[model samples]
Target: RVKIYEAMEAVILGADELDMVINTGNACAGKWDAVRKEISDLVTATPDTVHKIIIETCYLRDEDIIKASIAAMEAGAEFIKTSSGFAPAGAVVGDVGMIKQATKGKIGLKAAGGIKTLSNVLSFVEAGATRIGTSSGTSIMKEVR
Candidate 1:
């Protein structure tokens, strides 16, 4: 985690003009109040970093998911991601919608996890996901073309 922050700081400072910082960590699962607070502090400490809280939605209850979304947004997160793909449920359209609804357009939404095909990517995009994280980016685009 410290290493990630160090890298982020380096990238932010190395660039002549830094655009945004997307914090890709599962800070939204189970009891995340403490995690949320820590992430919030990180963002506050690094005012240049635009934190994007990645909530692994698989392990969280619906209420917890909502709470985490709210917490991330309140903590100054610029985006809320659906999953990290290391959990049971993974990313789904419904989960994307839930995060979208929870954030109320205040933050961007990223849908990730098992997105391997063009259709899958389109599904997420159609479902209001502003960003698509996938290892199959090349294949998906090739398939689309």
Candidate 2:
């Protein structure tokens, strides 16, 4: 499948980390096994690379977000990411807390998408984000300075 190929390609290109988005439709439909299998496959395809499973929190309910995070962790991913940065909304603080609870410190947490300010980054970190992904790191730094 394309997901597997992308994982393989990332590894081939010397990518140390791979961020793969999960199928939100499956998760929303309660097809947890399928979601788990997809992530598991990608993890298998790139054993040497760190895998971050993006759950796209904007489309999911609180419970769904927790379930997705758990599935990703059980599937052998190293991190559970909040968004792909293409959704209408991304990386909410409440969602970050839910993911942290679901993961139980078993995996890393990344909060991404629309994180543009130092306050945003700090709030996410306070809410248990292990990593912060943003396109405005420089601007955030400028705010700090």
Return the top candidate by lDDT.
2
TM-score of candidate 1 against the unseen true structure:
0.77
Q: How many clashes show up in model 1?
A: 0
Q: Candidate 1, 53: how far from true, in Å? A: 1.0
Clashes of each: 0, 0
**In candidate 2, how many Å is residue 135 off?**
1.1
User: Which pairs of residues collide in model 1?
Assistant: none
lDDT tens per residue, model 1, 49-109 = 5566767777666777777778888877777777766656567887887777887878888
Could you tell me every candidate's TM-score relative to the true structure? 0.77, 0.97
